[model samples]
Target: EFLFSSLVETSTAAELAEKLRADVSPYWAVHYRFGKSAANLSATALAASSLDALLINVAAPLRYAYLRQQGTEDYRERSIEFLCGIKPENNRLVRAFGKSLQPVDASESQALIQLYREYCERRKCFFCRWGYRFLSLSAR
Candidate 1:
């Protein structure tokens, strides 16, 4: 928590990445507590996948949301730039969506998940902009 708080206060994405690797690694090494079966982990013990997961799932979303809420276009663009610059995630949903719609990075994958959960799963096609437009055209 201390590492993340310090990391989050940084003014730029590069700083955040640096703090995550440098500061967070030591914190994880000393205080990281996983299940009993898992071995005690050091800074070097953490995998790229774990850090990528944090970047994708937590940092990007929060940054984008805060920028959007504040109505700042430049910061929003920065948030997106940070997201698109990250490595792509490979999971079942990303793979499934990739068959038809390839997600170039973690941001697109997150967008697909949001679309599926918020629109597709709820059957809210009428409320979707593309779906509403398609329906209007079909009716015309």
Candidate 2:
């Protein structure tokens, strides 16, 4: 867990899965047969599985606990991209932003997703770039 957390803190999303698998393999090999098969796992599958496990088993409970004690402020910077109930398009859009924006970190990605949900999904066009342009043109 510590190694996984360290990788999360230091590695990019692309690097996290392979790093986690490499780092955990020895321990896994000693304890479970599944660990032996992990070597054949694709990076995409590993990342998705690891993310699901972390979010469901670790992050959700921790967020709930923190919310109970101190409220949302404590988790304001945390990423909710993979959490249940979020639309998959939000995650895909964030990835697209990363490609176009070139270096969108977790917090920035979260902010972009929030902006998309609040403005794009809700059709708050005047507040968004394309919307503002459209509104201005219509006004003209």
Candidate 3:
């Protein structure tokens, strides 16, 4: 948390964020929207789980299921390579969680990819209440 505060208060958040991402790692302190996870990602408990992508799916919470980490077979799905647009006020996840951006395992990215693969095979997302909520809403 202190790391983020110092970065924010330094008037150089953008610079630091870029530096971190250049390493091909998501910033642990933000709420980035990589895509969405196929498994449950809304409980807050799993919000920062090692297998959890730092990104959140606001428009479609079930989009969480669609998010991919760097090492996942579908990791390419989560790549923000083609993004270009007028972003919303809170596009990145960092602003949402920086205040308590605890230190995550440096190995989180790999672990998350594995978990995502397992989650996909089981197709347990259909059982996720949050997933059901997103699915139901899409029909409307």
lDDT of 2 at 86: 24
Q: Is candidate 1 or candidate 3 better by lDDT?
A: 1
Instruction: Assess each prediction's global lDDT (C-alpha) against the native.
Output: 0.68, 0.49, 0.32
- The model with the greater lDDT, 1 or 2, is 1
TM-score of every model? 0.59, 0.39, 0.19
Q: What digit string (tens of lDDT, one per residue) describes model 3 on residues 1-140?
A: 44433322322222333323422234322334555333433333232222122222221122223343223464233222111111222213223223333223323323333333554346665665534565688889
Give the local distance difference test score of model 2: 0.49
lDDT per residue for candidate 1 within 28-119, as digits (tens), equals 55554653332555455546777778887888767767667778768766776777766677777566544666788777877777776787
Tell me the tens digit of each residue's lDDT in model 2 across 1-140: 57635433532333433444544444454454543554553333344555645544455445545554555563433434323222223357556444444323344445567666878789797888855875898898
Looking at model 2, residue 62 earns an lDDT score of 58
TM-score, structure 2 vs. true: 0.39
Model 2 residue pairs with clashes: none
Best by lDDT: 1
Question: In angstroms, what RMSD does candidate 3 have relative to the true structure?
Answer: 19.1
In candidate 3, what residue range of length 10 has the lowest lDDT sum?
80-89
